[model samples]
Target: MARIQTEHGGRNVQVDEYKGKKIEVATGYDARSDRWPVHVYIDGQKVSGQASADNMSEAFDYGFALAQREIEQQ
Candidate 1:
């Protein structure tokens, strides 16, 4: 398992790789917000992209999709 620890929206968020894949197994949040921020990384390189929404679930869904797209592109 691999993990990337980064801060977003003043909150600490960690994206962990599961089964040795680029897909983030889980997203962590330590702050309160209707929207959650995501820190994306591809092949150990951090990707510059902002994904957020008023809904935390939607935000995470978008982030996960973005991550998957990035991984496929690489």
Candidate 2:
């Protein structure tokens, strides 16, 4: 079973575990770009892709979903 853990700050972070592997979603505001940048990690390895959203909440959702898909496909 997996559960989500979230923390809020300058960088919003969410963490989960799937099949004993750790998945992390991090979102941060990019002032220069006026976008929220999202980063997804699985078991400490960063997934390669350009992910961004217009808002912090959306960024977190996108990141979490992306991470789940990556985990499922593996």
Candidate 3:
């Protein structure tokens, strides 16, 4: 597993990839509310695009869980 970090506003957020399976983790901002957003993807497919958690760990976990659920469903 490799840990990837995406930086925004000079703050780096760590996102873990499972065996480098093309999982991408990125952050965005909600312009309307000025809130930070965390987005996760798998194989270039979006797993979750939501705003949650103040820390990277929880945000990444949410994305990872989403990926797991998607895999189980398929």
Clashes of 2: 0
Q: What is the per-residue lDDT of model 3 for residues 1-74, given as tens digits with 9 covering 90 to 100? A: 46567675534345555644566666544466554466766777877445565555666666566666665666
Worst 10 residues of 2 by lDDT: 1-10
Measured by TM-score, the strongest candidate is 2
* CA deviation > 4 Å runs, candidate 2: 1-7
TM-scores of all predicted structures? 0.49, 0.83, 0.53
lDDT of each: 0.56, 0.84, 0.60
Summarize candidate 1's per-residue lDDT along 7-72 as a digit string, tens digits. 444454556563355544223443566455665555566768665565545555666677776666
Candidates in descending TM-score order: 2, 3, 1
Clashing pairs in 1: none
Q: What C-alpha lDDT does candidate 3 achieve relative to the native structure?
A: 0.60
Model 2: per-residue Cα lDDT over 25-52, one tens digit each: 8888899999999999999999999989
Cα displacement (angstroms), candidate 3, residue 25, comes to 2.0
